[model samples]
Each structure stands twice: as C-alpha cells, then as structure tokens.
Target: MERSRIAVAGASGLIGGALVRALTADGHEVVRLVRGAARAADEVRWDPERGSVDADGLAGCGAVVNLAGAGVGDRRWTPAYKARLRASRVRGTAALAEAVAALPEEVRPRVLLNGSAIGYYGETGGRTVDESAPPGEGFLPGLCVEWEAAAAPAREAGVRTVFARTGLVVARGGGAWGRLFPLFRAGLGGRLGDGRQYWSFIALHDEVAALRHLLDTEGLSGPFNLTAPYPATNREITETMARVLHRPALFAVPAPVLRTVLGEMAGDVLGSARVVPARLLESGFRFAFPRIEEAVRAAL
Candidate 1:
C-alpha cells in the first residue's frame, strides 16, 4: 500500500485509537484532530461543537475518518441525554464534513469514512438485515439517519464517503466484553431479556481491519455493515462467554427488570438485530473470527 497522509477525528476513542495505531503501522502519516491544544507533532486542534478546525492540518491529507461522537450506551436515555447524543453525532460530523468541503480540491482528502451504527435497523427480531435494508424506526434509527446526513457536505464535495454501520464490537481491553467480565467471572452472567433476539457483533481486530479495507478499497461507498457474517442471539453470546470463562449461564435478566433499571435505554440492550455484512462479503472481505464461540474465546 502506498503511504498516505490521513487525518482522523476522535483519535482518542476506542475504534479511533485502534485505527490510529493501524494507520501508523501501515506507514501512514496520521494527523489527529483534537478538541483543545495540540498535544504532539501530528495533533491538530479542532472544536466540533463550535465548527472550528485547523484547515492547515487537513491540507494534503489523502483520507479523513470521522469517529467523533457521544457514547450512546454511556448513560440512561433521558430526553436531554438523547438530545446530546443526536447533537454530538450530527454536529461533530457536520463540522468535519464542512471542514473537508472548505479545503482546496487538490489538498482535500479523496475519501471520508464516517461512523454509524447497526442500531439504524432498530429491533429486527431474528430477521436478517443488510446494508440495503431500509432504516428502522425509533430513536436509534432516527439518530443514525441524521448522523449520516451530516456527512452530506463531503459527499457533495466529490469526496468518496463511506458510512460504517457498526455492530457490537467485542474487545478484551474495553467495550462491552470488559464491562461484562466481572459478572461472567462471578458466574452471574446470563442472557438479557428473552435471549431470542439476535445480537450482531464483530471482533475488534476485524472491526479495525474492515475500516482499513474501506480506506483502501476505492470502489466501496455508502453504508457498509461492519459485523461478522454470523450474527448470534443474546442467549448464544451469554452461553459462549460462560463456556469460555468456565462459568454458569443460567441467570437471565428479565426484560421488566432491565427496563426498570435502564429506563428507555434498556431497549437497546434487550433489542434484537440480526445484521449481516452483505456488502462487505460481496466485496470479498474475509472475517478473522466469523463465529461467536471463536470470537468470544479469542477475546477472553
């Protein structure tokens, strides 16, 4: 692969951090867009909330990956929290898109990979969905809709745009897996709700690889479902984790309890989405860990 100059927003987050490391390892010049003062040689200050960024930092960059956004699962879904969630993604993405659009044609990055989520599909029960599937209804889908729309400026500016509709990313260091480790180790891990709802997931390594692939593969565009080919149910994931850690998976969290504890946010944890990486697979992308058991074992 040819060495390229890549500017990445939200370089401090989980996926962003991994992407930075991956890009650096691949011999690319990485410019990190920070919110405050420049912390290092490659760091550039950018305030998305104010739509301010260093144009000089983005000059001559071959690609820009916007991973900036508020954490959806970080708190309960209060009305104010929901507004913040929507604004965080929309405003931040629009800021990057506007910055990229404002750049000179010759210096502007040729591609922009914006982040999205599989929650766009809402609760699909056990039915399998792909990139071609229509956006589902509800808060998550609405948020994703606006989030992707915020990147329209880049697309209109002739930059190839790719919206990564990510699924549950499982990693040992952080994310969902880390949060559930204690419960699983204590033998209190179990399925959420009825355990029949499908849960789409991807290994962190695969997630990183897919992003790299999107950056390299010029023909790819639009919404790409970033998930393993095989999407398992909640029960399956709990069972796999239990088996992998040598624990019991008998204790299941009832839906009512989850709703009471998590409020509207509980639907996210209990909902089912059997998402498939149709576009990715059709494009010849191979998954490192396609099965739930293998992914959980490796992650553990």
Candidate 2:
C-alpha cells in the first residue's frame, strides 16, 4: 500500500491509541487531531467544544478517523453527564466533518470512518440485528442516530464515509472489558442482571484491524458493524471469562440493584444487542478472533 497522511481524532483512547500505533508501524503518516494547542509537528490542534479544527493541517490527507467521544459507562447518567455524552460525540463529529468538508475536492480524504455504536439498535432483547436494521428506541439509540448523522457534511462532500459501529471491545488495558479482567481475576466478577442480554464483542486487535480494513476498502461505505461473527450472551461471556481465567464467576448482580447503583445507565448495561458483522463479512473482511473464547484468551 502506498503511504499517505491520515488524520486521527481522539488518539489517546484505547482504540485510537492502538490505531495510531498500527498506522505508524506500517509507515503511514499519522497526524493527531488533539484537543488543545499543538504540541508537536505530528499533533494538530482542534477544539470540538468550539467546533474548530485545523483545516489547513488536515488538507490533502488520505483518510480521517474520528473516534472522539466520552465513555458511556464512565459515570452515572445524570442529565448533565448525558448531555456531555451527546455533545462530546455529536459536536466532535460535526466539527471533524465540517473540517473535512472545507477541504478542496481534490485534497479531500478518500474515506471518513466516523465512530458509532451498536447501541443504534437499542435494546434487542436477544434478537440479532445487522447494519441494515433500523435504529431502535431509547436514549443510547437516539444518541447514536445523531452521532452518525453528524458526519453528513463529510458524506455530502462525497468522501466515502463509514459509520464504524463498534461493540464491546475486549482489551486488557481499557474499555469495559479492560475493567472486567481485573474483577474476574479477583474472583469477584459475575454476570449483570439476568445474564441473558446478548453482548456483541470484538477483540482489541481485531477491532483495530477492522478499522484499518474499512480504511482501505473503498467500495464499503455507510454503517458497518465491527463485532465478532459469533456474539455471545452475558451468561456465556461470564462463563467463558471464568473458564479462561480459572476463576469462579460465582456472583450475580441483580437488576434492581444495578438500576439503583448505575441509575439511568443501568438500562444499557442490561440491554441485549445480538449484533452481527454482516457487512464486514460480506465485504470480505476476516476476523482474527471471531469467537468469544478466542477474544477472552486474547484479553487475558
């Protein structure tokens, strides 16, 4: 592949950090679209809150990956925090899209992989859905709808944009799965609620690879599910973790208790989304770890 400059927002997060490393490792020029003043030649300043980006810095880029968003499960879903979540994603994405749109047609990137989530499908209740399914009800799904729409500017500009609907990324260092490993290791880990909700998960490495795959694959555009082919239930995932770590996943967090503890965020924790990577598979993208067991082992 020919080397090209790629601008990436949110370069400090788990997926973003890994993607930056992977792109640079392959000799691709990576420009970091960071929040705040530019600290280095490779770092370009952009403030999503202000809807400002270094358009000149991103001029003539080959591709742009916008992974800017707040952690959904990081805090309680107080009205203010929920607002923060929407703003961080919707505003940040619109800012990036506008910046890319400002570029000359010839200089515009070939693709824009705007980050999204499987929450677009809302609570599936063990029902499987793919990218083709319509957006569901609830705050998360509603937020995801707006989140993906924020990239309309870039899409309208004819940049082959992709809504990268990512699922629970199983990594040892960060994300919900990162938080899970330690608890399971301590033998304090257990399934949430009824342990019946479906979890569409991807290994960290596979998640990065899939994003890179989308970057290179030009024929693909629009929403694509970046999850394992075989999604497992919460109970199945819990059992796998226990077996993989040789620890007893002996406890169960009750639904009402979780609701009381997590507040509005409990709905998502207990929601079921049996997602499938139909688009990714049909596009000929292969998964390095398609099974939950494989993903668990990788996370371990």
Candidate 3:
C-alpha cells in the first residue's frame, strides 16, 4: 500500500495516540494538530474553542482524522459542562471541515474520519443497532447528531467522511477498563443499574485496527459502528472481568444511587446500546476479538 500524509487532531488523546502509532507503523507520515505551544516542529497548534487553526499547516495532507472533543465521562453533566461537551465536538469538527473546505479540490485530503460514539443510538436495551439504525432521541444521541453534522463542510467539499461510532474501548493501559480494574480487584466493582443493559465493547487494538481499516478501504463511507461482533450485557461484562481476574462480581450498583451520584450523567452508565458492526462486516472487515471474553482476556 502507498503511504499517505495523515494529519490528526487530538493527537494527545488515547485514540489519537493509538492512531498515530498505527499510522506510523504502516509507514505514513503523521502531522499532529495540537492545541497550545508547538511542542514539536511537526505539531500544528489550533484552538477549536476559539475557532482557530493553521490552515497552511494542513495543506498537502492526504488525510485527516478529527478526534478532538471534550471527555464525555470526565465530569458530572452540569448544564455548562454539557454545553461544552457539545461545543467541543461540534466546533472542533467544524474547524477541521472549514479548513479542508478552504483548500483547493486537488490538494484537499480525500478522506476525513471524524469521531463519534455508539451513544448516538441511545439506550437500545437488547435491540441490535447498526449504522443503518436511525438516531435515537436522547441526550447522547442528540449530542452525536450535532457532532456529525459539524463535519458537513468536509462532506460538501467532496471528502469521503466517515463517522466512527465507537464503543467502550477496553484497554489495560489507562482506558475505561484500566480505571475499573483496581476496583474490580478489590471486589468493589459490580454491575451498574439492573445489569441487564447491553454494553458494547471493543479491544483497544481492534478499535485502532478498525479505524485503519476504514481509512484504507475506500468503499467505506458515512457511519460505521466500531464495536465487537458479540455484544454483552452489563452483568456479562462485569462477571467476565471478575472471572478473568479471579475475583467475584456479586455486588450491583443501583440506579437511584447512581442517579443521585452522577445526576444526568448516570443515564449514560445505565443506558444500554446493543450495537453491531453491520457496515464493518459488510465491508469485509473481520474483528480480531469478536467475543467479549476474547477482548477481555486480550486486554487483561
């Protein structure tokens, strides 16, 4: 495969860092779109909140991956925090799209892989959702809706836009699973809410691999649900984690306590999204770890 010049926003983030590593491994030249001081010579500093970016820095780039966004689970959903969450994604994506749109047709990157989440589907219970499923009417889904719409400029400019609707990426190193490992080892980790809500997950390695696959496969466009083939319930995930770590997973976190503790954010933890990789499978992309057990074991 021919190498391409890839520019990545949010290069400091988990997914962005993994993508940089993967792209470099695949012999692509990576230019990191940073925010603050130019830490490295190759870094392109931009402030999405301020709607500013170095457009010239993006020139000649063959591809761009927009992963800039506020951390969803980082804080309690205060009205202000929620607004920031929405603005962060919308504004950042719009900034990239605008920059790309300003470029001449031939020089502009051919593809833009924008970040999104399975939360776009809202609480699915046991109903299997794919990219073809309509957007759910809820906070997260609404957030995702606006988030994807923010990239319209790029799509209008004839760029092949891909919305990667990611799931809970399980990684041993400082990801969601890593944060829960200590608690689980101490026997404090248990199912959240009723434990019946479905939890879609993907190994960090496979998540990165899937993104690369999306980038390489020209036929893939629009939204792709980046999840494992085999979806599991919250109880299944917790119990599997316990079994993998040789610990017990008997306790359960009630919904009321979660609601009181997390407020509106509690709904996110309690909600179920039984998402499937319909587009990915149809595109002939095979999952390295299709089952939760395989993903958990690999991450552990």
Give the distance in Å from residue 133's predicted Cα in candidate 1 to where it truly belongs: 0.9
Tell me how many clashing residue pairs each candidate has.
0, 0, 0
- The sequence of per-residue lDDT tens digits that candidate 3 reaches over residues 172-191 is 77557878888888988899
> Candidate 2: lDDT over CA atoms?
0.92
Q: Residue by residue across 1-300, what tens digits does model 1's lDDT show?
A: 369999998888888999899999989999998887997889888887666778778889999998887788888889999988887788888988888998999899899999999989998987899998999999999999999999999999999999999998888776677788788999889999989988899998899999999999987889999999999988888988988899898898899999999999898898899999999999889999998987887676
Alpha-carbon error at 166 in model 2, in Å?
0.3
- Candidate 1 has a TM-score of 0.97
Per lDDT, what order, best first?
2, 1, 3
Model 2 Cα lDDT, one tens digit per residue, 2-62: 6899999989999999999999999999999988799998888988766788888888889
Candidate 1: which pairs clash?
none
Residue 28: error of model 2 in Å? 0.4
User: Which regions of candidate 3 fall more than 4 Å away from where they truly are?
Assistant: none
Highest-scoring model, lDDT: 2
lDDT of candidate 2 at residue 114, scale 0 to 100: 92
